[model samples]
Target: MLRIGRTPRQKPGGLKARTGIFGRLKKDRSGATALEFAILAMPFFVILFASVETFVAFTGEQVINAATDNIARQIRTGQITFNQGKSTDKTRTEFRAAVCQEIAVMISCSASEAETPSKLFIDVRTVSSYDNLPPTLPRTGGAGSDINTAGFDFAPGGPGTINMIRIYYRWTVITDLVRPYVTNLRPAGSSMPNDYLMVATSTFQTENY
Candidate 1:
């Protein structure tokens, strides 16, 4: 009798072993790549934005400080008028111009260089003698209405005295990205309307005999 050819029997475990290897490979694939990217990107973006804002705020402060210091020096040296005869408005305009120029140089920002003329406000107060005792007195009032109402008096035969010069500037950020965060870094609105106030005071004793 011719016997039927018998096929070799396959091992039952072989198929299961192949399936297990493929399953593990699929599971090990780098998971949630998109989620990983999103998580990593947020902090970088926040840091970058914060750095930009901080730099802008710092630069603005430096520019304002330098401008105010220069104006104070001019007043102290008598280059700018503080007496009653000269037009206060005219002196104010000139002081503003000088400050703007100085700030432009300091910051090198086009916005700073081309600031709106209306944004600059200056007040000069002169007191020849405080309480009629000395030739001059220390100038005060950087944050109140007292400076606006007070007047400096010249001693008879005493030198001219300029009690104070206050410079106020309303600087608007050209880069709006960081404006809100830094707006409060400036002086309070009580001293300035739209922005911060930089007050530089210089007391001068008249050299005129």
Candidate 2:
């Protein structure tokens, strides 16, 4: 018995099985692409939405500024030809209508509901004289960037007066998901975290009518 050679060894099946398992793992590509996509999906969508939001914001900005400039033209041309104070009430109503009328249709500038006044916060006032005009238009403060609708003064001035029209808008993000990538200009305690401020100003002297 002792003279028998080394015991017959079992076939290396276990080793071969491990090698096959590792081989299959390397060749299996089903989940590889999915795994990569899962890792990059968040950033990809964030960029996509952010880019779209930027374009929309720029468009809205142009709308507000252009609308204010256009409205200013009316006052400058004497279309708003009215005396101050006594005629202020009527002028305000008409001017407000005009602002909404020429508002950017794409933006939600109208708020018939009491809860939302108008998305457009406006102030039209005339300084005592052109010499008194400040380098920057006067504005009341609120939650930092927010303009309280109550503080809006609608005084388009009388003919031959210097008047300024100021507009403010709180453009909100369609989704909060992309907010981190964009700057949040709204002050602290803002009603919405996704809100950004937009302001436009137009100043011109009302011509003698």
Candidate 3:
């Protein structure tokens, strides 16, 4: 007796053969849901993080404004007096202390608080008259100052001298989306690195005391 070998033939649509119309219909559709979620999740997170960043920056600016306005009254009413001579270490410390009192409580006001004092820059100037007052916003001069240009003297002039206080906080943007949109004043090679700038200013004449 002669035995013949024969191969097993697959039917037109086998259970494992995913090639025909029936196979295509039976294919898994669960992955479609995951793909849809992945497509939408990215934009959702971007928008969410961007909004959080905006809120943080805006609130910080408002805090700085409030703190500056609150401190200006002290200078306006002559509570904080200026020495007739140059700006001494004691005067600088006292001014910083006053600023820190209101600002440090809310956010890191001084670089000293965070190991970098330039992070918060204060400029205070008292001139004999408003005619001597420099442009308020978009200051062309350098960072934190509490003095006048005349020999770089502390011009918190006594009795009825016009005074101006300017505060700047280099606020870093949280999200990358905001960094480009927000203001970035610091140059690329600067010691102090920041993305956005928060500025607060107040001007008043000192009371005769």
Using lDDT as the measure, the top candidate is 2
Instruction: Report the lDDT tens digits of candidate 1 across residue range 1-209.
Output: 98799889877898889989999988974777976878888777666775875676566666776776676665555455543354432344445556667777544334433333345445455554655333322234343222231342222122355455545454554444445554532343544322333333344454443
Clashing pairs in 2: none
User: Candidate 1 or 3, higher TM-score?
Assistant: 3
Error of 1 at 159 (Å): 5.2
Overall lDDT per candidate, in order of appearance: 0.51, 0.71, 0.68
Q: For residues 24-87, write the lDDT of model 2, one tens digit per residue.
A: 9999999998999999999998889989988888888888888888888977886664554443
In the range 1-209, model 3's lDDT, one tens digit per residue, is 98888978866665546566566767868689998989999888878887887788889899999999987787777667677543432376567767777876568654464333556667777767778776644533454322222332233556687888887777777676545555455454434434677788888987776
Give all TM-scores, in the order shown. Answer: 0.52, 0.78, 0.69
lDDT of 1 at 135: 36
lDDT of 2 at 137: 33
Q: After TM-score superposition, what is the CA distance of residue 144 in candidate 1 from its true location, in Å? A: 16
Which TM-score value belongs to model 2?
Answer: 0.78
What TM-score would candidate 3 get against the native?
Answer: 0.69
